[model samples]
Target: MSYNFKTIRPVMPAKDMINVILSKTQRKTPTVVHPGYDISRIRGFYMRKVKFTQETIHEKIDAILQDFPKLDDIHPFYADLINVLYDKDHYKLALGHVHACRNVIDNIAKDYCRLLKYGDSLYRCKMLKRAALGRMCTTLKKLTSSLNYLDEVRKHLSRMPAINPFERTLLVTGFPNVGKSSFVNNITNANLDVQPYPFTTQNLYVGHTDYNFVRWQVIDTPGVLDHSLSERNPIEMQAITALAHLKACIMFFLDISETCSYSIDQQIALFKDLKPLFKNKPLLLVMTKIDIKKFEQLDPIDQQKLQDVIQSENVFYSQLSNKSGEGIAQVKEKACGLLNEWRQNLKPEQLTGGNPNLLREESILQGVYIAQPKRVNQNRMPVIPQVIGKLNRPTLKDVQEQNGGAGVFSFPLQEHFLLENPDWKYDAVPEIMDGKNIGDFVDADILQRLEELEKEEEMMDQAEIEDPEEDAREEMLLNTRDQINKKREMIKEEHHMKMKQQVKLHRPNLEDAKEDFAKKGIDTTFLEQRAQKFAAKKVLQKQKRQQQSSDDSDDNDMDIEGNDRNQRKGRDALSRSRSRLREISRSRSRGNKKVLTAQEQAMERMSKKIQRRRRNEAKAGDGDTKIDCKMPKHLFTGKSGIGKQSRR
Candidate 1:
C-alpha cells in the first residue's frame, strides 16, 4: 500500500484497493529513499498539476524569435503552447520547436556531461535540470545532429590508424549551419565554436589529433552556402577554393533538417559537381542527425534511398550528436582509416636515383604503370602506344605509386605532361649517338647531377598552382594555344586534301558529284547554299502548277463562248468537269496545308543521290594507302618479262 497517491505506478493499480490500504496507515510508516533530490519528480508533478496562463505561454513562445529567425509562421509554436495547456499529447512540433527545444536538450546534455565529470548522486538536484522527459524530448528534437555525432564516434572505434607521414585524409564539408560546426565541435573538442551562428569562423581552421598515435588533420572550413566560387555572398572564398585541388578523401555533409534543407538529389548533384574536384578520391555518404526523425517519416540512412545520395561502395553511413560527443572518435577513426587505405592504394611513388632512392638502379621508371589495360601475353605488358599525342608518359619523379604496381598510370597524362618529361634531359648530356655505347656514364658525378635534377623537378612539380600576377602571361599562353589549335586544324585540312587527291588519283571522275552540285548553284561545299536552292526549287515548281491551272481555265472559257448547240452542251459539261476538278483540288489542298513543287521533289531526289554518291565515295576512299608500289626484286630483277615467262 502507498501513502502517496501520485507515486503509484501506472500498471500496478486498483484505486479502490489502494484507498482502503491508505486508510489503514493512521500514521506515516515506510523506508526512506536515498538522499539527493530527484529532479524528475518535481518536474513531473508540475507538468501534471500546473496550468500555464496564456500570457506566460505567449511570452515563452515570443522569446524564441530572438534566438532563431529562420523559422516562419510562429503560429505553430503558439499552437504547441495551447496544446500543452489543454493536454494534447499527440501534437508533434518538429518545425515549431527548433530554437526553444535545442536549449532544453543542451541543458540536459550539460547535466550528463556534469554527472560524467562528478560522481552520480541521488541528491544532485542540478544533475537533471528542468526534467528527464524534457531532456528526452529535446534530444528527440535534435535527432539529426545527435545521431550524426554517435555515428562518427562508432566509426572511429571500428577502424585503426596508420603510421605518420603515411596517413591519408578525409575532409568532411558542407554549407554553413548544416551541422558541420556542431559536428566538428562534438567529435574533436567540446568548445571550438565561439557562437552558434553564421560566419562564426571567418577562415579555414584545421584540427589535428593522434588517435591511436596516427597523425591526421581534420579540416573544418568556414560556413559555405549554395553558390559558385566566384559567385559567393562573402568576399571570403577561402573554404570553397581550398578544396579546389585537394588529394584527401571527402565526406559531403547533408543537413536536411534546417531551413535551407536540400533534397537528396540536390545533395547528390552537388556531390557530382564536387566529386570531379577530388579526381576519383574515396567519397563517404554522411547522413547527419538520426535522433529527430518522426515515426511516419522515412529513415534518411536507408540504403536504397541513399543510392540516390551517393552511388558507390566508398560511401559510409553515420549518425552524430555534437552535444554529447557521441560519434566524434568514430568519425576521426573513419577519416584516418580511409586516409590510410588510400595511402596504401596510392601507386607506390616511383624510385628515381635523382631523389636518392633506396631502390636498385635500372629499376626506376621501369615498372608497369597501366590502369586496367588488357593483358596480351605473359611477357608483354600493357603498352601506352607510341602515337603522336599519346607518347607523353609520367616521369619517374612525377608518377605517384598506385595499387601494388599493376602498371596503372597514376597521373592524368595530359595535366602531368606540362610538369615533367621523362625523355627531356634536365641537364646537357650526350645521347646514344648512331651506334655509340650507352653505359659509359655511371660515375658518382652523374649520380649527383641526377639527384639535383630530381630535387628541382620535385619542387617544380609541387609548384603547379594558381599564380596571381600572370594575367598577361596567361593571355599570351592562350594566344599560343589558339595558334597551336589552328596549326592542328590546318594539318587536319592538309590530311583531308591529301586523302582526297590520292583517292582521285587512284580512280578518276569522283569529283563529278561536286561539279553537278555547282552547275545548279548548289555550292555543295556550302550547306547554306543547298538549303536556299532547295527552297527556290520548291517556289519555282509551285509557280509552274499555278500557271498550268490558269491556262486550263482559259481554254474552258473559249469553248463556252464560241459554240454550236452540241458545242455549248459540251462546253457546259467541260465547265462542270472543271468545277469538280477545282473542288477536288481545294479538298486535297485543305487536307494537307503543305504543298511542294515538282522541281522541289526533283531537287530532293538529286540531294539524296548526291548523298549516296558521296557515301559510296567515302566507302571507297580507304584513306590513301601508303604502300610500296615498286616491282619486287625477286620477280623482276635482271630479267625481261618474256625471258622470265619462258623460264617459268
Candidate 2:
C-alpha cells in the first residue's frame, strides 16, 4: 500500500528493537582480540588510554615475534607486560603496555642517539684535516641521516590518527544490539548465531528496504566497535555493495550497558575505519540505554570523562530499555523528527541529479545512466536515488555557527556542551610550555585568580591595620640580601686574616657554603637572612644581653659613686627615726623629754621638700604668659633704632 507524502509516519519505538538485541545476547561471545588499551593503567602529569591483559600479551608477543623474525633483542619487561595486558587485571597492566610501547620507541631511537652523541666530536675532528677519520666521519653522517629519518617515522606513529578513516566507501554502524539485522536478515530480525564467542555479531551486516512515501530506500547496517577500529574481520559483500552502489548511513547504538564491552581504543579504531565514508555526514553516535545510568552515581569526574570523549554537547545518549519503556517516547520523537527533517529539504528537481545511485524514479530518464561502470567515467550527471538511508541536508555536524564559522553547530541541541560536560581544570588546548602539559586547567585555578583579585582589592584595608613592627620586619627583608652580602664579605675578611697567620696552604672554595639550601620550589625571602645571622651576630649580642640582664647594675654603680646620696640620706633618716623611737621609750623610763624624736624632724624635712617642689612648679607656670593679640614692643620696633633716635 502506497501512501502519499502527507505526514511522516511514526516508526517502532527503539525499545522493541532493543528488546530483540537483549534476547540475542545469550548466544555466546565471538572470539575476538581483547583490546589492551582499556585495561592498562598509567600515572603521570596526564591521563592515558588503558591497555590489554596477559591473554592479549601472549597473542601480541607471538604476533610480533612472527612479524619481525629477524629482531633478536627483546626486553625482558615486554614479557611481563604481555602477561599483564593479556591475563592480569592488576590495573597496572594497561600502564605496562604503554611503557612497553614507549620502551620500544626508545630502543628504536638508540641508533640515532649513539650517532648524535659523537656529533660534536666528529665535526671537530673533520675540521682538523684528518683524512682517514674524515672519510669515516662522512660515512657516519650517512648513518646519522638514516637515524634521523627513523626519528621522523616515530613521531608520525606517535601522532597517528588512532583512527584511519581514509577513502573507504561504507560504514556498518549502529548502537549495540538494535535488532540491526545483518544484510541477510532483511526478511526477519538478525537473530542467527554467526560469529565466534565475544564478537557474536561477526560478519558485516547490510540490508536495503524502501521507505513507502519517500520513494527512497533505507539500508540496515551493523555496528562499528567503539574505541578504535580493527581491520581483522573478513569483508562483507552486501555491506560493500551498499557502499559502492548506493549511498548509505550506518546507525550505531549501545545496548543496555553503561560501559562498553569493548575497550575505548578498539571502539575508536572501528570508528576510524568507518569515518572517511561519512565524510560530510554527522558521525552521530546514539546512546540507546539512557535509563541505565539515569539514577546511578553520575560522579562529576566520571561525567567529565564522558564529556571529554564525546565532543558533542547534546548527549547523543538516551536509553531504550525494553523491560520498562522509558526512552521509547523520546526515541520515537527523535526518529520521526530526523526522518521528517531529511524529507523536507529534498528538491524533486535535484533528485537523481547531484547524487549518483543505482535505482531511481523513472521520470528523470533522459540524461541519467545506471552506475559508474569504469569506476571513473569522470563524466555524466548525478542522481539522488530514492530516499537514501537517513540522509540529512546540512546534517547537524555540518551546520556552522552563524556569527562566525568557529564551531560545528546545530540549534536543536538542548544543553550547551560547556554546561553539560565538565572541562579539564587547565587549558582545553594546552601548549607545551617548559615541557609540561600546560593543557591541564582547573576551575579552582581560575577561582584562585579571582580570589587574588578580591584580595588585592582588600589589601588597603589590611595595610591600614598592619602592625608597625611587622611592617618594619617586611621592609627589612628588602635589604636582607645586601646585608647578607656585606656580612658575607666581613666573614670572608675574617677568614683571610685567619689565613694570614697560617702558611699559605690550600683553602676550601666558596662553593662549599653555597650548597646549604634547596633552590627548587622554596620561597627563601624570610628565612635566608635569619639563617645567616644565626651564626654572624651571636658574640656581640651575647655580651650586650649579659650586661642588660644584670638587674640593678646601674643602681649598684650609682651607690658606689655616691650619686644616690639623697636616697641614702632618706634611708638613714628612717633608720634614725626608728632608733629615736626606741630611745624615747627608754627616755620615758628615765623621765627625760628635752629633745624631739628624730621621726618628727625627718617628717618635717620631707614635707618641706615636697612643698618646695610644688612652689617651683607654680613659679614656672606664672613666668610664661600666652598673649594672643600683640607682639612685644622690643621685637616690633627695633631696639637699636629707638636708642639712636633718643640719643639724637
Candidate 3:
C-alpha cells in the first residue's frame, strides 16, 4: 500500500479546541432558560448543551486520530521513516492521549447529563451545564503538551516528501559529501543542496523520473556515518531506515578522490556494515568525482582493495563525475536496468504469496500452435516485375500542388463515375421540357402500356353490358335481403323494450278514443259525456283552490299590518333613549368614541399604523392559518427508550 502523509489534518491545541467547542455549543443550542419553564424542559435544554459540546470535541479529536497514519497498519518503509524522524513510542503516546481525552469528554458529558435529568430548578440545570463544560475543558487542557506535539508533527508530516513504497525506487545513499545529492540532481529533479559538507539532506527527499515509460521514484537519503545503529542520530537513521526497509535498487555512493573527508577504506567498511540490509536487493557501487581522481590513477593496492570489495559484495560498480557529468547517464541506465531485471526475476510466490489469481502466466500462449514446414532441397524466391522498378507515380498531394492546391482546387468528380458510355457521364436531363414532364416519358414503353390498359378496361365494360339478366337477378336478391334485415331490426328493438324495467305506456287522447270508437261502430255519446263531466270537475276543483289561497293571503296581510304598527312604536321609544345616552356619554367628538388617556391614544395610533403597514405589505397576522409538522421524523422514527423521546 502507498501512503501520502501530506494530507493529515492540522491538530489544534487544547485550549483553542476547548474554546471552539464551547463557542460552537453556545451558538448552536438555546441559551435562554426561565424559572417559569417546566423542570423537564429546563433539564433538557442544559442536557442538549452538554451533549452538543461533547460531540463537537469528539468529532475534532476523532478526525486527528483517523487522519494520522497508524504505525502498525502502514508500509514498513514509511513506518520506519516515521519512527526515525519522530520517536515511535512518543508518537503513539501522543495519539493515545488524544484518544483517551476524547473518551473522557464523552464520559463527563454523559455523567453531567444524567445528573441534569434530576435537576428540579433552572438554576440547578444551568450549574450542571457549566460543570459539564468545565470538566470537558479540563480533560482537554491536560493534553496540552500532547496536542502541541501532534500539531508540530502534523506540520512536519505535511511537508514530508510523498514516497510510494511499492513503486520502482532507486535509493541513493553513502557517506557525507560523496556526491549522492549531486547524482540525484543529475538524474532526477530532487535539486538538493550540493554543499561540500556532511548531512546536507537531513530528511528523505523523493524525486520522480521515468524510465522505459514507467515512473521510478528516486529517494536521496541523508548521509550516514561510520558508526553502530545505537550511535547514529535521527538524521543518519533516516538513511538507515530507508536502506533497511525499502525494496529498492541501492546505489551506494563512494568518494573515489576522498574529497568527502571519508577515506576509501572507511567507505568500503561502511558498505560492508550495510551489506546485511542489501540482501536480495540489486546493489550498485557508484564511484563519484572521477574528474578529481580517476580509479586508474589510484595506487595498485587501492585498486586491488576496490576490486576485492566489489567481488566480495557481489555488486555492480561504475564511476561517474558530477562536476563533468561524465558517465552519469550510464550510471542511471545501469541502475534502472538492474532494478528492472531484478523485479522481472522475482518468483511469483515471493510477490503474491502463491495466490493463484495473482500468478503470472503466459496467457497469450494458451491454445496457440506453431506449424513447421517439411525441409526441402529446392530453393524458392519471390518474383518481381521489371516494369515495377520504373514506375514513379504522382500521388494526390502532388497533383494538388500542381493544380491550385488544397481548398482552391476541386477534383473532377464526374471523371470517376462509372457509366455504360463515358460521354454520358456529363449529360444533364431537364425535369421539365416545354409543358410536359420529362420524367413521365422517361420510359419508352409507358404509352404502349397505357394503351393496353385502356383496351382491357373496354373489354371488361362490354362483358358487363352483355349480362343484364344476371344484374336484374342480383338487384331482386338485394331487395329481398334488405327486407329481411329490416324485420330483424324491428324484432331486436322490441326485445330491448321488453327487457326495460319501466316501459312507457302510450295513452290515447279523448279525440283519438272517439275516432277509434266511431271507426268500430260503437256508441260514443256516453263516453263523450263522461269525458266532459271529468273535465268540468277538474276545472271546478282548481277554481276552489285559487279562491282559498286568496282568502289566506288576505288574512296574513291584516296580521302583519297590526304587528308592524306595534313594532314601530317600540322602536321609536328605544331610539329616543339611545340618542339621550349617546349625548350624555360622548365628549365633543364628531362620532361616538371612547375617551382615552395620552398613553392609550398613542397606543391606538401605533396599532393603526402597524395595521396599515401590515395591510399594505400583506404580512400574516397571529390569526393567519399555519401548518406545523405535527410529528417530526427524527423524533417519531427509529427505536426509543424511557427518556430518549425528550432527548431526541
Candidate 4:
C-alpha cells in the first residue's frame, strides 16, 4: 500500500513555540484586578491561566508525535528503509526528547498551580504564574536542534516515492551511468531524475503500470559502486535495502559500450558482489546502448563474461537502446510475464478427492472457484398481466383516430393504469373479507326508512329558530360592560403617566448629592466606609453558606457509610429531600420580591451598569469623556472626499 505523508502537520521551531505560548498567555489573562475583588477569585484566575498555557503546548507536541508514522507499526520493508535513510536510533531519540519535555512542562504547571491555590495576595499569585511560564519557555528553547532536525526529516519523507512492496514489481539496479534510470523512464511513466553523469539518481523512485489489467510496481534505485557493503553510504544503501526486501523481477542494466567509464569486467564484478541479494528472485541481465555498439562488436573477453552470467538457470538476457527507445516494450513484457508465472508457481497446488483437513491450503485455494448458480423454470414464461405485447397495445394515434382526431376529444389520463381483471373495475362489492366478496344488503322497505329519517331532520331544524327580544337584551348587557372596562383602563394609564414624570424630576445624580454635602461642610468618609463594610459582610455570608453546605454533604456521606452497597439509593433519597427544601425556599423568596424573566433581568442589569458608569464619570474628573473647547474644523467637518476622483 502506497502512503501519502503530505497531510502530516507542519512542525514549529522552538522560538516560534515560545512566542506562541507568551502571546496566548498575555492575550487571554484578565487585564484588571482590585483589592475589593474576592481573594479566591484572584487565585483561581492566575492558576487557570498558567494551566491553560501548559495545556496548549502539550496538545501541539502530542499532535506532532502522533501524526508521524511509527517504525514498528509499518511494513518491515518500510521500517528498514526508514532506518537506512534516517538512522532509527536518532529518530527515536528526537521523539523521546520531546516526550520528556512534555512531562516536565506538565509537572511545572501542576506545582505552580498548587502553590497558587494557597496564595494570600494577588501579587504572590501573579509571580507564581510568571515563574511557571518562564520555566516552560526555557525548556522548549532547549529543543531547538531537535525540532529543526525533525522538520527537515518530515520534508524529506513527504517527497519520497510511495512504493508498494506487495504488488508485482520490477526493480532496476546496476553501476552508475549504465542506463537503469533510462530503462525505467522508457518502460513506465516514472519521471525519475536522469543524467549522463555518474550517480544522478541518489534515492529510490517508483511508478506503476498495468500488465493484462493487473497492476505492477516499478522501482528505480540508485546505482552502487564495486565496494564492500559495510563502506557504502546511506544513499548507496537505498539500493541494497530495496534489493533485499522487495519481491520483484530484478533487471541489472549494463553498459557494454564502455562509454560509462566502467569496464565490463568491473561491472560483472559488481553484479556478482550483489549476487547474494538476488537469490530466489527472477533475474534479467539487460545490455544497454545497443545502437552504439552491438554485442558482437565487444571484445572476446567482455562478451564471454556477459555470457557466463546469462548461462545460469532462471537468468534472462535482453538488449535495449534506451536513447532510440528500441526493444523497451518487449523487455517489459517478458519481465512481467516471467514474474507472473513465478508467482503462480508459488501458489499451493489444487487437490481433488482427498481429506480436506490434510489439504487445507489446497482446499482454500480451490474454494475460490465457485460454481455458477442455475436459473429455474427456464422453458416457459409466466402470464403476467402487466407484460402487454406491442401488437396488442393501444397507441396515441389509435386513441386520437377513434375520438375524432384534433377536436373535442377528451381521454381519461388513467385509462391504461388499471392492472386488475377488467370485470373487477366495475364490480359493486361493498366489502371483501378473507378473499370473499359481498355486496350491500337490499331490503324491500329501505325507501320508507330513508323518508322517515329525512323528516325528523327537517323538524329539528325548524324548532331551532330564536326570538328577537332575547337577542336585544343580551346585546345591551354586553355594551354596558364594554364601556365600564374602557373607562377603568383610561384611569390606570393616566395615573401611570403622572407617576413616571414625577420620578424623572425628583431623582438626583450621586455627584450632585456629594457636592451639596461638601458645601454644607459635611465629610463623606463615613458613607464610603459603610459601603466597604457592607461588601465585606456579603463575602463573609457567602463563605458561611458554602461551609454549611459542605458540612451537610459530609454528614450525608457518613450516614451512607453504614449501608451495604446501597449507598447510592440512600444518597439519592437525601438529595431529593434537599432539593425539595431548596424549591420551597426559592418559591417563598420569589413571592417576596418581583420575579423578573430572563429578558427583563438582562435589561435591568444593563440599565444599572450604564447609570453607574455615568455617575462615576461625573464624580471623578471625567476620564476620557471630557471634550476640548478648541477643535480642528477641517478635520471634524469637511466636504465629503469619498466621491472625489482626485482623492482616489
Candidate 5:
C-alpha cells in the first residue's frame, strides 16, 4: 500500500530455514550447566533455547504477512488488478498455510518444554530439547511451496506501477495494435513499446504529464479483445478492471488502417459492448494512426459506423498520427480542458466560493486601531483592609515639600535613637554642656547666618545675569569648579596624614624581648633530653605488654600438654563415640550429605586442635610492636664524613 514493495524479504528454502534455526540455537544457548547449580537455574537455561527459537521463526513468518498489502484494505482498482494477476483464493490459501505452520511450531515448543521441565538427568533434558527443535524444523519444511509462491508474488508486486485510483487519470485502451501504447509514449514520459505488432503492451504501463499545473496520469492498459467477460484472459481482464474501477477520462483508440487485423466494424462493436463502463465518465474517441489513412478517406459505410460514438452527448473525437507526431498535443490539451471543466461542473457549489469570512480588508484595517471599552464590575466596589485605613501616610512629594523644596531649604537630620532609649526622642548634643540653656546657644544665630548666606547667593546670581559677555561667564564657571576640586584634594591629604600618625602612636616596642633567656639567668640545656624521655617511656610500656602476652601463651601451651597426658585411651574411645553420635544428629537436622564415621570424626577434631596451636605459636613468634626509631638509620645516616666515620 505504501508503494515500496521491494522491501519485502526473499523467501528461505526449507533446508536453509531449518539450518538458520539450528545455527541460531547453538550460538544463543549456553554450552554448560553444572549439576551443582540450583535446579531452577538449570531448567531456565534449557527453556531459553526453546523460546528464542520459537520467537525467531514466528518473527520471520509474521514479517512476510505484515509486509504484503491486504487486498481488502487497498483501493478497488488495485484489488481487482491483483485478483486478475494472481487468483485471490490461491493467495489467501498460501498465507493461511504459513500461519498454520507457525502455530504448529508454537505448539511443538510448548509440549517439548513441558517434558524437559521434569527431566531427571542432563542427558534426558538434552534429548528432549533436540526433539522439540527437530519437530519445529520439520513443520517449517512442509511450507516450502507457500514460501516460494509468496516470494514470487513479492517480485511481481514490486515491478507493478504505483497507481492512485483517486487521481485524475486518462485510460488509454482499445483493441490490440490500435496505437494505445504509441499515443501514451507520445503524450507522456512513459517508456511504452511502440511495436507495429498487436498486444505489445501486455501489462499496465502508467505515464504522468502536467496539465494546467495539475498532474494527470495516463494508464496504458493491455488491449482488450472483443469477447464475453468469462472468455477474456487475465491480460485482457486487467484493462477491464481499470475501466470499471478508475474514475477517469477514457480514450478508446481506433486503428482505422485495419493494420491490427481488426475490422472497422469489429472495433465499433467492441465499443458498443463496453459502453456501460464509459457511463458518467469523460469519454474521448481517439482516431489513431492517421498517417496510414484518414477517417474521411474511408468508405461512407465506415464513417456511418462511427457516427453513434462521435454523435453521443459529452463525447469528444480526435485524429492523431503517432508515427508522424501530428495532432498529439491538441488531443492532450482538449482532453485536459474537458476534464477540468467536468470536475468543476460536478461540484457546482465549489464554484460559489466556500470561504466563510464576511469582513472586507479596508474595514478590518480601519477598526484594528479602535480602542474597546474596558470591562469592569459595576455591582461592587473594591474593599480596603482595616489596618491600612487606620494609618496616616503622606505621599513622598508631600514629605519632600515639608522638609525642603529642592535647593532652597534643607532639614537638619536628628537621630531618634528610638530603639536604644525611647524617652530620649531627640538626639543628645554632645557640644552643649549641662545647665547651659542648650536650645538658646545652639540655634540663636541660625536665622542670621541663613540670611547672610542667602544674600551672598543673590549677589552671585545677579553678577552672572548682569554680565554681557558669554566667554566671561564660562571662564568664571570653570574657575569655580577648579577651586572646589582643589579643596577636596587638600582635605583628602590631611586625612591620610592623620591616619599615618595614628598608626605610629599604636606601634609596639619589641626591643625588650630581644634579651636572651640566659642573660636573665635561666638554664635551658635539658630541653632536648626532656623531649626524647617522653618517646622512650612510651616504647618501654609497649615492650612490657608484648612480653606479658607471650608469657601467657606459653603457660596456655603447657596447660594443654598437661591435660593431654592426663587422659587415658579408654576416655579417648568414649569421646570418639560421642563425636560420631553428634555427627549423625547434625546430618539429620541439617539434611546434608552422609555423616562421618567414628575414625573420621576423631581425625577431624585432632586436625582442628593442631591448627589452632600452630596459629598461636605463629602469633607469639612475631617481632615486638614497639616504635623502633622516629628516623631510621638508612635515612638519617648521611654519606660518611670525608676522613673518618661518624657515629649517629
Candidate 6:
C-alpha cells in the first residue's frame, strides 16, 4: 500500500515550460518558408510549427499531471497525510488547471491548422501560426500560481518516507519528548533526533525491523495534543491520520517521570481522549524513561489510576528505558506478536478490502480450501519428535571453509552410506564378473523369485489349453469377421468403378456398342440397320460437295488466265481508256477466288479503320517490344536516397 513519491517528476514553472516547448518546436520543425513556393506547401510549413508546438505543450503538461498521485486512489493513511500537509482541494485544483491548459492548447492547434488550409499568402499563415502559439502560451502563463504550488509540493513529497500501511506496523505516538523516538532509535536504525524539546519529530519517520523472519514497519509520528480535531496543526494531524487509518498496533508512549513537561494525570487524560481512535485495534501502553522513575515509585493514587486505564481500555502494558535499553526487546516482541494475532483473526472479507462478492469468486478463493479426510482415523495424526535441535556435527559448508575452501577440500561421498556394517561403508565391489553384471545378483532371493515366475507362466499356458469351447468360439468369430471384410472391399471397388464410368466421356465404336447392348440384353439389329443408312447418306453428300467444288475451281482458273492476258496487253499499250484500265485493275486486285459477303466486307473495312487509328496514336500491341524510360527525370535527376529509386 506504500508508494514511492520520490519518483514523481519535478514540476516546472510556467515561464520555463513555455521556453522549453517553444525551443523544442523550433528545433524539430522546418525553419524556412517562402512565398514563391506552392501555396499548399507554405500553409503546410506553418501548420507543422503550430501542431508541433501544441503537441510539445501537451506532452509536458500531461507528464506533470500523471506524475502526481491522485489522493482518492491511494490508501487512506497516505490520502489523509497528503491532505494534512497540502490542502486536498488546492492539490486537486492545481492538477485540474494543468489538465485544462493541455486541452486548450490542443483546441488552439486544431483550429489554427484548419484555418491554415485556407491561408491565401505565406504571411497570413505565419500570423495564424503565431497567434496559435501565443494563445497556448498565454493559457499556460495563467497557471503560474498553480504550477508554483505543485513544484513546492513535489519537492516536499520527494523527501517523504515510504510507509507501507498494509504490513505489520507498530505506530508510536503520544505527547512529544516522551522517549517515543528514543524507543524507535534503539529498536531500529531510524536514528531520529531525540532532543529534550517538545515536537522535535515534526513529521512521520519510518524504519524496519524483523521478527519471526517477517518484516515489520515502525512509524514514529509527531506528538498529538489534547485538543479538538479542528484545532490540530498539520504536524499533529499527520500522527492522527496514521492512528485513524493504519491497521497496526498502537504503542502509546508515556513519560511517567514527568521529564517531558506532561504530568501523569495529563498524559492519562490525553490517552483517554484519543481512545476512540483505537477502536478494534491492538493497543500497547508503553511507559518509557523507566530508569528515571519506576512505575512502583509513583504515588499509590497514580498506580491505581494507571491500573484502572489498563483494565478499562483492555490494552497491553509494558515499560522500557532507551538509555539503559531495558525492556526494549520485550516491547518490540509484544507489539509484533499482538499485531500478528490481530491480523490472523481478521475475516476473509476484511482481508479482501471488505468486498463480500470477492469471497465468492473462485479466483480469490483458489488458494483457500479446507482439506478434510473422507473418514477420520486415530492413526492419521502426524508424529512429532520429542527433541528438535541443531545437530552437533559440522555442516559441509563449515567443513569446506575450515579445510582450504571449496575447490581444495572434497567431502567423502561414501561416508553418508547407510549400511548394516559401518566399517564396510568404503568397501568396493566389481561392476561385472564372468561376463555378468554383479548388480543382477545383488538381491539374495533373485533366483527363487525367477523360478516362481516361470512356474506361474507355465500354469497360465496350461489353463489356456484347457478351454476348448472358448478356442472354438474365437475361431468361428474370426472367420465371420474375415467374410464381412471381403464383402465390404468388393462393394467399395464396385462403387469406385461406377464413379469412374460416370465421369469419363466415351464414344463407343459399333463393335463396342453391340457388345454393350448384348450385355444389357437389348436388341442390336435395329441399331445396326440405322447406322448403315446414316453412313450411306453421309457418303452421298460428301460426293456432291466435291463435284461442285471441282466445277467452280475449273471456271476460276480460266477467268484468272484471261484477266492476266488483258493486264499484259494493257501494260504494252501507251494509253488506255479509263473503263479498260478499271477492268484490268479489278481482275488483278482479286487475291482469293472465294468472294466475301456484303456484311463481311463491311466488318473488314471497320477493322482496318481501327488499326489505322491505333497506329496514329502509337499504341503498343501485345507482340510489340517496349522499353521503359531508362532515365526518367524525376527518379534519375535527383540524388539517390531511400524510396527515390522508383516513382512508386
Instruction: State which candidate has the highest TM-score.
Output: 3
- Whole-model lDDT values for every prediction: 0.49, 0.40, 0.84, 0.82, 0.78, 0.85
For model 2, what is the error of residue 408's alpha carbon versus the real structure, in angstroms, after optimal superposition? Answer: 71
Q: Model 6 segments beyond 4 Å from truth? A: 348-648
Per-residue accuracy of model 4 over 39-74 as CA lDDT, tens digit each: 999998888889889999999899989977888877
Clashes (candidate 4): 0
**Residue 44 CA displacement from its true place in model 2, Å:** 93
Per-residue CA lDDT of model 6 for 194-223, tens digit only, reads 888899999999988889766778999999
The regions of model 2 sitting more than 4 angstroms off are 1-197, 203-230, 236-246, 255-260, 263-273, 290-292, 295-299, 308-317, 322-333, 343-648
Model 4, residue 525: displacement in angstroms?
A: 58
Which residue pairs clash within candidate 6? none
lDDT of 3 at 167: 68
lDDT per residue as tens, model 2, 333-371: 444344434433544333233223311442343335547
- Weakest ten-residue segment in model 6 by summed lDDT: 358-367
TM-score of each: 0.27, 0.23, 0.56, 0.54, 0.53, 0.55
lDDT-based ranking, best first?
6, 3, 4, 5, 1, 2
Candidate 3 local Cα displacement, residue 647, angstroms: 24
Judging by lDDT against the true structure, name the best candidate. 6
Off by over 4 Å in 1: 1-168, 189-191, 233-236, 259-266, 294-296, 299-305, 312-314, 347-648
Score residue 606 of candidate 1 by CA lDDT: 88
Cα lDDT tens digits for candidate 5, 92-206? 8988898889899999989888887897776677667777877888898899888888889888988998876656688988999888888888879998778878878889888
Candidate 1: residue 358 Cα off by (Å)? 15
Task: Summing lDDT over every window of 10 consecutive residues in candidate 5, give the lowest-scoring window.
Answer: 350-359
Global local distance difference test of model 5: 0.78
Off by over 4 Å in 4: 28-31, 345-648
